[model samples]
Target: MSADTVAAPRLSLNVRYNRNVQENSGEEEESQVEILEDEEHHADLRPQRARPHTQNNPAANNRRCFKATAVALGGFYLLMLAGLFIRFTLLQTRYDQLSNNNSQLQDEVKKLKDRTEVFKSCPHGWTGFGHSWYFKSEEKKNWYDSRADCQQRGADLVVINNKEEQEFVSELSKDGESWIGLWYEWTQGGWKWEWVDGSLLTEKFWAAGLPHYNGYYAACCIQQGKWTQGYYSDNKNWICEKMII
Candidate 1:
């Protein structure tokens, strides 16, 4: 009985061992297939290395160049605008200075015109003729005293300039022998005729050979337009003349 039992159990155990080994090998193959599938998925998820761009892209290069050129041109334009602004400011300052100068000139011109207008007419107590005034003295005195009186009245003895002025004086002084501006005095260059204004006599209205005097100096008096010499102390009426203001 024992022999038969042991033999049957050993044969069953050997068959079970072979069947378990086959099952385990099938599970291991399935697990290996799953692990391979997982590796393939992970490789797909990893970032791929980018391929180098060996050939030049003309469109991209042109875009980069255009950007650089635009920046440079913008900077140049900005500098030009700044320069123009500075120049305009300088011009404006110069224009202002010119305008001020012109205004000052206009004001000066106006003042000159006003002064010209004010000097056009003569004052009172004087008779106007040409650009001067004349006064006839009412009192009689010596030649020296007559000249002094004329000076106190802001004038001097009358000085006849032309034939017309001599005629006028002759007509005005016909009443008496009046003291005239003509006189002869001894100088370094001998005796010569002079007027009260320090000018040498150029024109003469003398009664011929009547200006002769023996003294070192002498005065002249005018009865009419003709001139004659006399002593400086001789009494006479006098005429005065002054420039018109």
Candidate 2:
């Protein structure tokens, strides 16, 4: 054996070992790349998780709307009821006042009826008429004082009922103006003529352009078969009447 021949075999063995190591490393790299690609494909095919969501309830929303509408309607009805109550209260007060006035007038009529039972015929100086007695005053006085005089004599200012009575009273006062029972009074429809017994005038016998006085200070007077209005404070003659029983 020669030293050169031994060295050549050792070099050939080293070259074979290096080639095998490079081939093993290349195989390992290819295996690792295939494994990574498989893992990515499996991850893409996996199931997805669901997201959170919010829901709405239509019935609950309608109920809330209905409650709000009911509350508003109830408030409107309450306001109407309050207004009606106030109106009723005011009407009741007015009715009570009218009732009291009516009662007072009825008492006065009753007293006059009682007085009628006492006089059977016309008095000594009074003139006789249908179912009543009449008296004409000679002196002049205001309407209030004239009424006072008649009341003292158990009579009142004359209230002419019909055309005949109207004519008779007018003839009786042919001399000058005389106050009658008719006077302007306060009523629901404003000032109007009413008799002393609290009765409204039904028949009228006004003069030409007469009965035209204004305000509550007016009274009726007879002049030549016609009626006229004058101030209640005017000095004038008056007629009185007492009912016969």
Candidate 3:
């Protein structure tokens, strides 16, 4: 094509009609040919350039809608997972608390059962406290003889366990000396004392400066509601005690 034809102006139909009216009739045939070629070229390019965007619009819209639906479904699944995890955690924590409460209740029931067994073991004329029995003796004897008398009756010399036991014995004595189960052991130390049950004496209510040992053979006795050390051969009214099965 010539350069002038390549750069030819693209005019509307109305502009071409006006140009034809103003120009000489001698150039009419040539002008008509150029306008006809320009129109044909424009018609070809209009279909080529515009057909792709128009045909693809529906497909582009469908792709955008599909992406939106996928995003919404993914968010819903994430929310469901989070809710399930939270519920599982709450249930596990509740189960642990219930387990702890059940264990505590079982312990309480066991204690009650043990206490009932101890109460059932008490015989006539014997007082019950904890898991043992107590008896007040009316006769007098030395510490060793007192223990022997208790043994004859299937019992032993009394062991004072706490303030309540000491008070019970003091009340029964009514301000007099009584042989009890505490004695020194040359098996360990000159000063070591323990109950007959082999348990060490950890607490005692003793008279002031009064556990004065008469050599390595001292025994304990209850006097005026307090513990006092005495010779093993000393004579006093005694108390007997026994343990439940």
- TM-score list, all predictions: 0.47, 0.48, 0.62
Specify the poorest-scoring 10-residue window by lDDT in model 1. Answer: 215-224
Off by over 4 Å in 3: 1-121, 215-224
Residues 120-234, model 2: lDDT tens digits: 4446778866668889999989889999999999999999889999888888888877889888888898888888988888988887875664543333344457887677788
Candidate 1 segments exceeding 4 Å error: 1-125, 215-224
Q: By TM-score, how accurate is candidate 3?
A: 0.62
Residue 205's lDDT in candidate 2:
88
lDDT agreement of model 1 with the native: 0.73
Residue-level lDDT for 219 in candidate 2: 34
Clash pairs, model 1 backbone: none
Name the better of 1 and 3 by TM-score: 3
Residue 32 local lDDT, model 2: 61
Candidate 2 stretches greater than 4 Å from native: 1-121, 216-224
RMSD of 1: 17.7
